[model samples]
Target: MKKTILITGAGTGIGKDAAFALALRGHRVLATTQTEAQSDVLRIEATNRNVVLEIFKLDITLEADREAIAAYPIDVLLNNAGMGESGSLAEVDMQRVRQIFEVNLFATLALTQVALRGMIAREKGTVLFVSSIAGRVPMPFLMPYSMSKFALSAAGAGLRAEMDQLKKNIQIALIEPGAIHTGFNQAMTNSKYQWMNASSYFAHQAEAMKKKERATFKFLEARSTQGIVNQIVKAAEASRPKLRYVSPWIQGFGIRLARIFGV
Candidate 1:
């Protein structure tokens, strides 16, 4: 059956690809980007593929954006928009940490709240939260982003139990993707480099950190975005979808193995 799906952060990365792919599958797709420029690019890219993708401006930070989404009869809410910021937990800038949470955690929950109400009324809908592998395993230097995703994982689990209690046909799912070649890694490196450069005491540590970041990026460039998108679509469309969908077999398998062996 065809469904109406709304995807956030469809301007780029996995969200962008998923929006187009879902549209190709004959579902009505509403793709939201943070900026007008991105909406324009999405419009052009989607038009060529005979995909019925409509682009809208939605900065999840704004109440107006959430209201705009409420106007649509959405069947699946793909909470794919997020931001990344990195720093050591001890001396990280509080403002940057708050800003990351504003986008990644707080705003995501607010938007989900809006979607949940609509889904509850109809008693049928699916919510897909695009979390990260960092949510599952601790990683160094990205405390803010990692913590936000970890919170989302918690929210997903709690929300699933609530849905069961309410007897709502609404499904709550999570996409815990491993590293993909999104601009997120580059942005993380740049933000940390700038922050460290501006600080007197952190310059030497920042230099060493940049070397490791370079290596990380080189290793991640080989990863595929398609697998993440596939898992997301499956989460949205499957009748009996798993509560959590982790992607790129190697990373997903390795993480599960680590959990099993307590490694």
Candidate 2:
């Protein structure tokens, strides 16, 4: 079945890869980026790759940009646009934490509500939230990002049950991607250094923390986005998608074990 899917953060990383993959699978993909420059680049890349994608600029946090979603009768809304910040929660700036929540949670839910209006009228649609494995566990410096995803994951599950109770054909699913070798993870992990200084707590351990993060990624991060992309495609195409789709099965398994053993 050919469906129209709207994906946020389609300018790079997993989102970009998923957009191209879906388009190649014969679905109409509306790939939106945060800036016009990114949209232009994506357009060119899509052309070069011979993939048909409707590339556009859509900053999810902006009201006007979110309003644009109503213009298209979308079959699926993939909330993949997110930002990250890292620091000890005790010392981190509160504004940074708020900003992450504004993008990762509030704006995402707002857009979901906008899309839901149309989906409810049509009596059918799907919503996928791209959460993180960090959401499942406590990440020391990555708490800000992890907190947002945790809230998002919880909201996604709750919404799914609500929609079921309403008897609407709308489906809600979560896409939990583990550390993929996309620059995203590195950038997020390095974010804390921007604010940390000689006076800050844990300043002395900075180098050690950086080394550990790098080593962890080297050994645990998946080298390709294909694992998560495959899960996204499956959820998008399935008539009754699972409540959650986790990629790089091994990482998901590890998380489950950690939770079971109280790690």
Candidate 3:
């Protein structure tokens, strides 16, 4: 039962790994990236692997990108493209806050809306959202990213309810991985945080941020991505997948603890 799947942010990290894994499993995959270089890389990789993969240029934040994706008759939509911002809540720039929501929340939600119509019409489609553990638990100094994932979790939960109400066979799954061996942590560290570096008051805080980032990267690199990919593929194919699929035992446990502790 091969399905036609479309994954956003397919250039790197979990998205790239998921796209390749799905394609290798015989799914007709449309792997999208924000730049031509990423698209080219995925195309070349898929070609070398002899996997059926189509590359698309999609920034997710653009209306044109959403319109282009609408042309594809996809059986599964993987919303994996998102950005992260790091700063203290009070120190976070207002413009940066908007930028975070613009892509992670607004754009992702808009694309979901676009895909929902098609799924509803077909009455048999899966939507997998790549949320994060931050959404479930409050992490320090990552408010911008956490807030977006929180919103995404809320949206996914609401949509799951809507599907139930309409009696639609469509399934929505959230892949909330804690820390996998993806460049995600590195990306978060590399993202815009110069404000902290430049601020005299926040300079010490910035050093602490770097230390935490290093520790995170070290821990993530030790974890295998196969587990997360397995969960995602299972969710995509399961006849009755759970409302939210958390990845890795530790992460899933942490989320459970968060719920119990009222985080």
Which candidate leads in TM-score? 2
In candidate 2, residue 31 scores what lDDT?
99
lDDT tens digits, residues 1-263, model 3? 99889999999878888888998888898999999888998888878877778898998988988978777777889999988887778767889989989998899989988887888888888888888888987776788889889888988888888887887788888888878767676776656466666654567666776787888778655367788888888988787678887777776786788889887
Which 10 successive residues of model 1 have the least lDDT summed?
Answer: 193-202
Decreasing lDDT order of the candidates = 2, 1, 3
Candidate 2 total steric clashes = 0
Best by lDDT: 2
Evaluated at residue 244, the lDDT of candidate 3 is 80
Q: Better model by lDDT, 1 or 3?
A: 1
Residue pairs in clash, model 2 = none
TM-score of 3: 0.93
lDDT of 2: 0.95
Per-residue C-alpha lDDT of model 2 across residues 154-196, encoded as one tens digit per residue: 9999999999998879999999999899898889999999999
Worst 10 residues of 2 by lDDT: 132-141
lDDT of 1 by residue, 1-263 (tens): 88899999999998998998898888999999998899988888877766789889999999888887888888899999999888777778899988988998889989999988888898889999999888887667887888888888999888888887898888888998887887777897677656665654566677777887888777865366898888887888997678889877788777777778864
For candidate 3, which ten residues in a row score worst on lDDT?
A: 192-201
What is residue 8's positional error in candidate 2, in angstroms? 0.2
Off by over 4 Å in 3: 190-192, 198-200, 220-222
